[model samples]
Target chain A: MRIVVLTGGIGGARFLRGVRAYAAADGAAVTAVVNVGDDAIMHGLRICPDLDSVLYTLGGGADPERGWGRAGESWTVADELAAYGAEPQWFSLGDRDLATHLVRTTMLNAGYPLSAVAAALSRRWKPGVDLLPATDQRLETHVVVEDGDGQRAIHFQEWWVRHRAQLAARRFVFVGADQAEPAPGVCEALAAADVVLIAPSNPVVSIAPVLAVPGLREAVVAGPAPVVGVSPIIDGTPVRGMADKCLAAVGAQCSAAGVGALYGARSAGGLLDAWLVDEVDADAAVPGVAVHPVPLWMTDDDATEAMVRAALRAAQSR
Target chain B: MRIVVLTGGIGGARFLRGVRAYAAADGAAVTAVVNVGDDAIMHGLRICPDLDSVLYTLGGGADPERGWGRAGESWTVADELAAYGAEPQWFSLGDRDLATHLVRTTMLNAGYPLSAVAAALSRRWKPGVDLLPATDQRLETHVVVEDGDGQRAIHFQEWWVRHRAQLAARRFVFVGADQAEPAPGVCEALAAADVVLIAPSNPVVSIAPVLAVPGLREAVVAGPAPVVGVSPIIDGTPVRGMADKCLAAVGAQCSAAGVGALYGARSAGGLLDAWLVDEVDADAAVPGVAVHPVPLWMTDDDATEAMVRAALRAAQSR
Candidate 1:
């Protein structure tokens, strides 16, 4: 089966490890349509957080301690940048991490599309899955804030890193998204997919941006493949990241029921043909969508593979 | 006196070390308008070679062994970039060196002009000389090449680093130079100078690009201050760098006299009112430009200060 998965970062990358295992055993092809909303230019190099997480995890270089960044990483470059008084000092650039950024940024400047660049970068990792950027154009995710002064738009990183997403967000704006065309092969992959799985990623920041690009969501909905979404929220909270803060911006509750309702059924114009929530939320109701309850924690390759198998069955039914 | 010096890289930076010493002792306000033509976006970082040289040399952090890059540099980043199969691999970005590039490239992307970024960077170095990029615009130096593949333009790094300047050049194009205006305050420094000394830098690549910028050379030639150029050539060859190859591109010889004649005098529409050559080449003459002979080698601070004194005397005569 041609499996197409939409993913965010760390959690998504780890889940990909499970998917890769399954695909390797079955000779299946997996194409991951990664979110570029978290993509940023830090220290002069373009960093696609989700893409890197997935790459590093599958490539066996991910740090077990931090759960992100390259394993056995050194901080010589970060210390130097700090010594020079570079601000937003929280995010770190490992010596090995910089190599990936340098290559990505260089190729981006050389006019290669981000999708092509991701493919080129993947050659070294050989992650057993095709990685595709949602769009090649600049589609920055911005948070609209109502400060004491007034309303203004803050770049995603400013909200995430600088403020740690503390401010009450009024709305989220996917800047340049209106004009952004889907990356080459993204629409085709979605249209041709036998199964479409949305991994438990940030609904507002990750999956939303992937869906925001012009033709991507429509393609998934129109395809013969059934679209399935795994809930990022277990009972009523995210496993990682500031997804609750972003969900609150759109006036949505943090519960699995709330997210499932937000993405009802394809016939109802919401995202889900099937919604997979945690077993804890077995009693949850998502109108017009096929709702199933499963153990959602992806603690190991076995747990993740179980989740993947459940998602595959959900898609196969429709 | 507010002294202004025009400089290139390595040699220019070493000369600035002596100038800074003289300026500190005499309490002179020194401003260096450095050439940015050697600047390139390497591996996605904005690399100002001349500015870096000045910063490292005056900050006392320059590698004594390589005479460029930082002291106690590590190549972890370069090794990783190589592992990823990065191109144009001759120039290595050491871990320490990568920090400077990261900071500069990040700031540039944040919309700070190169001149302002240089000012911000120099705060850490406190290089004593006010280092200003010659132009805010990207005026990359490109050599026009004629080969079996026909005529093509390659980046200066490709020609210099990758090819090692082995290819014969028909002409050197300062791409975007005609559209580039000098960075603010460059003309003001030129006009306000008591004396302007052109450091013993590569005449074609460094000095020529500064002159190539619209109105900068004209402003220098017409300013009240008498401008003097110190020949980079000694004993019919460049003291360092591939100045001979670049000089030949502009149809000039490698001898002190050949380069001296190339700059002629202000009245004849070139760079100098006076030309400084080695004491051995004192007889090498140009018609209108005053010629002075001095020990041009900056083997130490004392030698550099002596060269500065000689330049002042020559300016005083004119």
Candidate 2:
């Protein structure tokens, strides 16, 4: 099976790890389309948070403590940047992590697109799964907020990192989305895949931006592949991240049912043939959607792989 | 007296350590105009070799063993970059050193000139000396080599770091020098100084590029201050670096008097009221140039301060 998986940050990367193990057992090839909405320029490096998280997590080199950056990372660069009055102290750039930025930045300046850059980067780690950004062009997520006079647009990082996603977001704008082209192989991979899985990541901030890129949503819908999404929300709470806070920005409920409705059926153009929610919310229904009940907590790779297998079965039934 | 010194990498930064001590004793303000010829875009970060050398050396954070980068530096980034199939590995980029590039590249991308970026970087270390680049504009030094087809231009770093400066050079070219404007405050500091000291740096590659920029050489020659140059070549050898090789590229001999004649008196339009040579080369003479014999080895602060005082006396005599 040729499987295409769309992922976000830590939760998404972790879920993909399980998927990788399960897919290898079943003799399947995997291509990961990563979200770059969380990409920010930190300490002068172009940091693609979600992509790096997925890369590091799968490469057996991610810091288990931070669940980001590289294992056995040092902080000399971070300390120096901090001493230099660098802003945005929240996101730390470790010594090992800097190597990624340096190479990526160099390649980018040398005229390689993000997809090609990711391909080059993946060659070193051999993360076992092919990785691709949602789009080659920049698709920065920006949040509109109410200032003293009126609404002002803030870069997603400023809203997410500096403010801790605390303010009421008037709108989420994916800057450059209008002009961004889906990365090479994305459409072909979607068309040829046996299944498409959206990892349990924040729908509003993470998955939304991936789908927001032009032609990507249509490709997933038009494909014969069984498209399924794992719910980030369990009962009325997110499994990880500030998804609840983000959903509030769109005036949506934090419930699993609400998120399922938000990402409705293929008939409704909302990107799901199946939606997997926690056992507690098994009764939740969406029109033209196959719902499944599972433990839904990725306590270990085995548990997460079980969830992946269950989602695959649900896709087969649909 | 307020002193303005011209410097290049390693040797220059090391010499400044002594000058700093001497200036502190006299409570004098010192400004250092650093050579940007060695600066290059490696892995996309603008690496200013000389500026960082000076910054780290004065900030008490420089790596003593390697004599560049920061103390307690990590090489994870370099290892990763290498794994990604990066080249020019001879020049290592440490994690802590990357912070400086991050700040520099960021500021440059944001439309700030390099001189302004240097100021911003200096603010972090407060290295006491008013450090500045020779020119804000790109004035890259290129080596013209006899390639398989014909002569082609290669960047100085590639020639120096990659080839180890072993290739026979047809000529040396300072690209963009004709168009480059001397950085703000460069001429002003030179014009008002009591004494101007040329550090024992690569005469052709380092000092030449600084002089190549328009109006700078003229400013030095016309300044009320007397300009004194220290020979990078002692006897027939370079104290550090491959200066003898670089001297050959410019058709100059690797001797104190040979370099002094190359930077001849005002009648010849080169900036040299006095030329300081090591005690071993004291007998060598250049027509119409005052000569000072001193222990030019900057083993520590006391030795460098004595050299600085000798240059002052030479300038005062002129």
Candidate 3:
């Protein structure tokens, strides 16, 4: 069986751990098309936060408590950069994490596309699932916001990490999405999959940017396979991260029903055939979309695996 | 009085520390025309060993025990790179040192020249002497050698750090020197200098590459100021590094007398007005150049300061 996933952020990475575990037992192959909107060139190093989050989590190098970056990470390089007073002090560039950037940046500078560089880095992490970037071209997520300075467009990282997303964002802009081509194998995987799962990542930024790649959303909605999106919201709050702020930016309510409405329904020319909400949000409804209430909290691998199973069942039933 | 010096490598860096110390007391200005020939792009970083050496040494951050890099350096980045199995593993890219590279590479990518980048770094380091690159252009020192892989010209870094200069070098090529211009302020510094001194660095790869720039040698040789050189060799042995191997490549004897002969006399259309040898090499001689024997070991700052004093005296006497 082939299962394709659209994923990004730490929560999505954690969810993939369960997907990978389920595949191990059922002998299913998994392909993850990760978001690249969060990628940026800082200090001449091409940094891929979403890609690294997945790689680290799946490769058993992720910090369990922090849910991001390498376990037992040191900040020697970061401290030195700080000492040198290098600008953009917000990004927590750990030493172990910086190694991945060094290698990736080196490879990209040597003429390889982002997909090729991701593949090369995956060789070291052995993330098991076939991992691909959403787009090889630069597709940055820029947040247009009115801060104390004035209304301006800032990179997603500056808004999310530096400013803590406090300033109300007017909207999110996928800078290069109009010209971006889906990375190789993204369309093929969607076409060949028995089911497509959107991991419980931030919808407005993580999953939206991945879908922003030209023709990517169309490929998912038009493909023959069933598409299911697992809600990141539970009890009117995000499982983690500032998904509420992102939802506010997009004029969406911070609730399971609201998120289900955002993805909409494939029958109504949207992305999902089935939407999996938390059991508590069982009554949540989206027009023309089949909504299933499942135990959505991924408290542990077993719990997450159970959630993945519920989504798969939802796909089959749809 | 303005003092201009042509220098490179670890020895030159140490020599500059003494020069800095001397200047602090004498209230004399010091301008260093540092060699860029030893510079190379490694793992996408513009690595300038000599420039960094001088910065770290004069900034009170150099490892006194090891004679290079940060005093309390950690190899976290390097170890992680090894874990990923990144190629060209010979360089010890310390975490603290890698910070410098990131800032430099970023600035350079943003179109700042090496000289500008160096000056910016010096602001943080407060390296007392005014530092200038030999040339703004990419003047790389490549070693043409016959190894097990057959005859080929490899980067100076690969030849020096990887092979330990054990490979018999046919010659050293200063690639880009012919097309290069001396960095801004280098010619001005040399032309206005009251005296010029050549630091006791590797003649083949270090000092030679600095002189390789068009019209730079003319600025020193034909300028009004007298030029004095200190011998890197004492009793037929180099103070540090593989200068003997480099000397052998260029077919110059590894002796104080031989080095003086290589620099020759300004009267005979060569560089040196006088040469300083260690007290032990009293009999060392070069026909056209006056050679003086003095204490030459840089055991500490005071000893190194004494050497600077001797060189200054020689410049005055000439």
Candidate 4:
């Protein structure tokens, strides 16, 4: 069987671990269409936070304690950059992490597309799943917010990392989405998939921006396979990150049922055939969509595989 | 009084320390016209080895044992880059040093001239001497050598760092020197100089590239300031680095007198008004140039100051 997953960074990376474990047992092939909206250039280094998180996590190089970046990462570059007083000192690029950016930036500047660069980097990581960026072109998520003065759009990193998502965001804008095309193998993976699973990642900034890539949303809704989403929210709270703040920006409720209804039913011109939620939200409901409630805490690989099994079952039930 | 010095990397950096100490005691201002020939872009970073050497050395951050890079440096970036199988692995960039390059590359890409970038960086280092790149343009030293098949020119960094200057070099090419102009402060500093000292750096790749800038050599020769060069060779051997190999490339003898004569006399369309050599080469002769015998070993700041004192006395005598 072929399984295609739509994912973001950390949260989605943890979920992919489960998918990989399940696929290993089932002898199935997995392909991840990772979100690239979090990518940005800092200090002339192109940083793909989502892509790197997935690569490091799946390749067994990620820091389990930090939930992002490499294990035993050093901050020599970050500390030195700060000493030089280079602006945007808020986001720290660790020395180990900086190497990936250096190689990626050098290759990208030399005229390689993001997809090609991703492939080249993965050769070293050996990430189990075939990883592909949602789009090779620039498509960053910018948050529109009113801060001190007036409403203006800022890059998602500035909103999330620099401001701590404190400013009440009016909406999220997917910059360059209109012109972006799906990266190589993305559309093909979606078309050939036995099931399409939307990982438990921040929907507004992560899954939403991936869908905003022109024909990507259309492709998922019209494809011949079932699309199932695992809710990033449980008991009206995000498992991690500020998914609640992102949901509020889009006027979506911070609940399993709310996010389920947001994705809506693929049958009703939306992106989901089924929505998997935690057993705590078993009573939650989304009209015209199948809801599967199960234990969703991915405390370990075994626990996560159970969640993946529930997702696959929900896809089949639809 | 203002003293101007033309220099290269490590050896020049050490020599500048002595000049700084001597100038501090004499209450004189020093301007350094640093060579840009050793500068190159590696892994998308604009690495200015000569500029950084002087900055770190004068700023008291250079590794005394290594004779290069920052003291107490870490190699996380280098190790990670090696893991990714990045090319040109022979030249290692320390993590602390990489930060300097990032800031420089970013500013350079953002349209700031390298001279402006150096001044900005100096704000952090506070290198006592007024530092100026020989030229703000892309004037790199490339060595012509036969690699198995035919003769071709490779960057000086590759020849020095990667190959250890083992290849028999035929000649040195100062790429972009013909069209290059002196950096903003270089000509002004030289014009106002009371005296000029050529540091005991490699004459071919180091000092030569600085003079290759159009009209710069003319400025030093025709200006009222006397120019004195310290011999890189002592007892027919260079104090440090491969000055002998480089001297051979241009078919010059590896002796104090040979190098002194190579600079000739400022009145004879060449560089020096006086040449300072070690006591071992007290009888070393340059027909048109005055030669002074002195101890040239820079064991410490005091010893280096003595060498600088000798250079200043030579300048005064002429």
Top lDDT prediction, candidate number: 4
Error of 3 at A3 (Å): 0.6
Q: TM-score for all predictions?
A: 0.84, 0.93, 0.99, 0.99
lDDT by residue (A30-108, candidate 4, tens digit) is 9999999999998888999999999999898999999989999989899999999998899999999999999999999
Against the true structure, whose DockQ is highest? 4
Which CAPRI level is candidate 2? medium
- Correct interface contacts retained, every candidate: 0.88, 0.90, 0.82, 1.00
Interface DockQ of each model: 0.64, 0.71, 0.83, 0.96
Candidate 2 has an lDDT of 0.86
Q: At residue B52, what lDDT does model 4 achieve?
A: 97
lDDT of each: 0.87, 0.86, 0.92, 0.93
Off by over 4 Å in 3: none
For each candidate, how many residue pairs have backbone atoms clashing (under 3 Å)? 0, 0, 0, 0
Q: What stretches of model 4 exceed 4 Å from their correct place?
A: none
lDDT string for model 1 (A1-318, tens) is 888998877878888888888888778899999999988877667888889998899998899768778998998999998899786587778999889999998898899999999999899998889999899998889999988989999888889878899988999999989999889988888888888898888889988999899998888888778888899899898978888998999988898988888777887988798888999999888888888899999988989889988988887775
TM-score of predicted structure 3, chain A: 0.98
For candidate 1, the iRMS in Å is: 1.0
Q: For model 1, which pairs clash?
A: none
Candidate 3 has an fnat equal to 0.82
Residue A28 CA displacement from its true place in model 2, Å: 2.4
Q: lDDT by residue for model 1 over B1-318, one digit each (tens)?
A: 988899887988888888888888888889898999888877878888889999998998899779889999888889889988997588788899889988888788889999988999899999999998889999989999878888888877788878888888778999999899989999999889988989998888888888889988888888888898888999897888898998888899898989988877787877788889998888889778899999998889999988888888899999
